[model samples]
Target chain A: MSLPEDYLRYPLRRRGMDQDRYEWRPRADAPRRAWPNGAKVAACIVAPLEFHMLNPSGKPFKHPGAMQTPYPDLRHYTTRDYGVRVGAFRLLDALKRHRVRITFAVNAVLLTRAAPLIEAITADGHEIAAYGWDTDTLHWGGLVETEEAARVDKVRAAFAAAGLAPRAWLSPARSQSFATPDIVRAAGFDICLDWEMDNTPVAMRTAAGLLHCVPLSNELDDRKLLIDQRQTEEEWRAQILEANALLQSEHDRFGGQTLAFTLTPYVIGQPFRIWALDALLSALATDDAVWTATASELVEACA
Target chain B: MHADPNLYDYWPYRDRPRIAWPGGKKLAFWVAPNIEFYEFDPPANPSRPGWPRPAPDVVGYSQRDWGNRIGHWRLMELLDKYAIRGSISLSTALIDHHPEIIEACVARRWEFFSHGIYNTRYSYGMSEAQERAMIEDSIASVEKATGQRIRGYLAPALTHTERTFDLIAALDFWYTCDLFQDDQPQPLKTKSGKVVSMPYSLEVNDVITYGAMAMSPWRYADVLKRHFDQLLQEGERSGVVMCIPLHAYLVSQAHRIRPFEEALRHIASHADDVWFATAVEIAGFYREHCWDQTIADIDRRGLARPGVGFAP
Candidate 1:
């Protein structure tokens, strides 16, 4: 069980950014911050408007619910299309009914395909946050910094063409390299929501300037809860209630906290599960302590 | 590389074979406690590196060693309380280094399976002869220590060479926890004898859920509950396998251990609906009753070649 000293000199495998990007500050140690209108808790709902390639190379299908049978999986393809066609509207109507504002993390390519949906989202006064160019293109597996910068520029141009100014960025599938935070900051996004390391929003120093890292719940996400974990509707509802209660208690002790609830139309857009979202929103709406805001609003308040 | 289609015949999940476990249970549940011993420094594999940090990785080694010293005992107590027998995935080297830990597991009558000689040692670039020798060592060590022949193989840290499956089958192992393509026990195409791939989950594994996903202990419990709930509902149509893989270092931390206990307790409460069995028991039952029929069903669907084995 002994080894050579040469192994020690091998290149260190770095995955994400080094710790120098942000200082170590516990959530409890941070200064007390309050949400707008003296709200106890700030809640943000993120809806990812994504487009999966019909025939992704290597893997036959894109996701679990995608068709598993033959090539040209029309079943899964159209099922994804159902998000823009029907699910997005259902979510929009629910948000309207509950009087909650949401942020649609839209892929730049989705704007070309579903411009009307983008218009509808804007008309309803919801925020548009840039997700990526598309689901197929990613920044993780050896994607160089130059190419990533180009992709970011393209995404910004797409948002501008759509008459929207997106100040936030959430990578597709939360995939990024060590240079992602710097690249994201250089691309002019004021906030990045991919990092889930902390419960409270922390500031990171990128090459360009300061970038706010808004934390999202990796466990309570709709895709993980409903599809990957196969949680029943009852369990999904319970998780929301339980998470809200815990965050409220944390607020009572430390200070105000943010709860970012992520929903994807393809997963939570089903007729049966849509009610859970409705129920969660309705419950949150009844609570006077909950301040449902978009990601930008929360980041602005913290800034 | 993508898996060879011939290795596992395509069986669309919708209307496939109906597998019934003992007592009409919908799902067969098992817990695999990977009691391992990681060396402070080990020979390097040409394919992959050993540690993320520098050599003499005291932090990495001691973190895993803490599992044997303290975490394993706490976990074992919880398993005993739930009446769940662990299929101990042993690092064969532990038989020499930590006989006391092996003795405790043996006293509990838990089943033993080979993970590898050492958690630090890997099978990435081993020649066929080297791999065969390692397998033989596993067989001899486990039988000498626990008095039970090894029935399963999970590659050390889930690493494998090209010929891992064929070698395991050639050695007459009944099941493997490597192939994670399906929820049910599916037939694997090997060189010599038949081998069924058990549905051991990387999704629910404590290491992946807590360490990799960065979820809190309570969140980890919530995930386990949700995973079990969905699998139970689906099990009504076809019997499924639910595996909760544990590494004492991750789940048995003082703060994390209670949630792990609570999750197991919640699962154990559904005793009537699920079959609490070892990996060997599930593989044995499937081999005796449902293996042939499952293969036949795959053949009837025209998904695989009849006589040819997997070439990959």
Candidate 2:
């Protein structure tokens, strides 16, 4: 039997990242702008402080950073929790030594569970950006708009109670639905770090206002580099240096380019891998061309 | 019909039959260079369009055409430099349009496998007779051009009918590279004869890595190195297979080729550990020795069943 013509239409083409809402604007067309203190490159280090629930719902749908295998995967679960227990501290100390203030994309659940750690981060003069309620509760995987809104509200309430009003939102697993931007805007987020489509920041048209998508590097993430790709620590260091060099060359032409180093504490916080982070932070700190700033600071400068 | 749920007999990686290559090597590495012919405007299969944009897509056509005209040579030279023999996944129409490319590959003693008549002409909506004709055409045309009977099948752009595996097996093809489920070679259930599914990666393929993932050439090199490193480690126990699928248009660009060569260099540097064998060689080796035991193990585990139509 011949396959029906409608077979193609059933699994509808994946129309990723609405072009109407976020149109492609060339880097050269971007306005001539300078980062804070006239630095050429804005290096935003996003450290995700997360918690993978002991038991996930096993919803048949999974994304990167989601729990794989089965329930009570203690080896995987404890390894993920290691980010909060030991990795986050190593990262924090490394950043402190380099005098770099990072943006910690905190899961709201960690606000209560690891309150002291969150408090220590804020006290260090770093920015706290929302990274969903928990790692398991994602906005893209069949999450309704109302529930998504509630998740945002819960995150905001936690931040507000701690005298923090996070202006940025980085979704866990970088998952997003059609209503995500509008919902994010309604929830009072100014910048989003989920979209990895471009190198430069692009303005996304939303109902509330223009939401700035501060482009994150999908290639340079620790989870992708270490866990998924299984690169050596030396290769990870080389990737960072090569990426920065390329971006630096591009920045020379375009001017307002941001380099976001996305890090998951669990992945990069290990004793061997943590040194790569130290090397990267130390290298970036010394580079005068790179203006190391939090995600909020970079957003404000671009604004 | 869809793919057979029981197409591949399951045996756990831990307890599977041990596969040994020609040189007692741990991993069987093969590079599949897809030498394709994408027409400027072709007859469409209703299931999918020929191009992303409306046809007479000059830019799209010329870019792929560039692979045949220029990129293929550069890539061939690089592959030759590393003493790597590519298993050319030929879109058979290239034999008519660009016989010189086919001649060049034949001269190098590279293996030829069927990738359909044209890359644009998919097998999505083909009738049983049409699909059979396409397969027969692949066997006839490839044999006529290169004096080599096609031993393997990688469906056009990986589009296949439920009967694809069964058809290939009936036609005496040794292996199919369309299955992406396993790391090791395994027998595919067919009505006629045994056809093993060889490991061909979409993960490490240049088209997916560069075009779909939008990764840089240097990053691609890093990924390839890491992939090879991990597979080599895994191969120390039971043997592993690594297929690096390449498209000339993507990987043979001026800047990209050198980094790609760097990846090949890294892989080649581990010459002692890896057996750089073609898909046919790997399948032949497995069939001669491990085939019966592997199938028996899977049968004992109650995995060797008839089709259930869950085509990959």
Candidate that scores best on lDDT: 1
Ten-residue stretch with the least lDDT total in model 1 chain B: B1-10
| lDDT (Cα atoms) of all candidates against the true structure | 0.79, 0.79
DockQ, in order, for the candidates? 0.03, 0.03
Q: For candidate 2, write residues A1-303 as lDDT tens digits.
A: 888898766453455433568755666666766886667788888988887764566353454655543222332444465567546766787889899999999888777666667877887889999988777677774777888788888888887887778889988777887788988888899889998666666778888898888888888887898767766567788888777777778766777677887878877775446667878888889988888888777777877
Docking class of 2: incorrect
**lDDT score of model 2?**
0.79
Best by DockQ: 1
Q: Which of the numbered candidates is closest to the native, going by highest TM-score?
A: 1
Instruction: Show pairs that collide, candidate 2.
Output: B3-B309, B3-B310, B3-B311
User: RMSD of each candidate?
Assistant: 13.5, 14.7
**lDDT per residue (tens digit) for residues B78-164 in model 2:** 988988999989899999999999999999999999999999988876888999999999999999998999899998877776677
How do the residues B1-312 of candidate 1 rate in per-residue lDDT, one tens digit apiece? 322224555453445578889999999999999999887878887655677776788888889989989999999999999889999888999999999999998899899999989988878768889988998899999999888999899988776665777898988999998765566888787878778888786657887677655678987887787678767866888898999999999899999998777888888999999999999999999999899888788666424554333363
What would the TM-scores of all predictions be? 0.57, 0.55
Q: Write the per-residue lDDT of candidate 1 for residues A63-100, one digit (tens) a residue.
A: 33443423333334444655765468668878998999
Which residue pairs of candidate 1 clash?
A: none
Candidate 1 wrong stretches, greater than 4 Å: A1-303, B1-5, B305-312
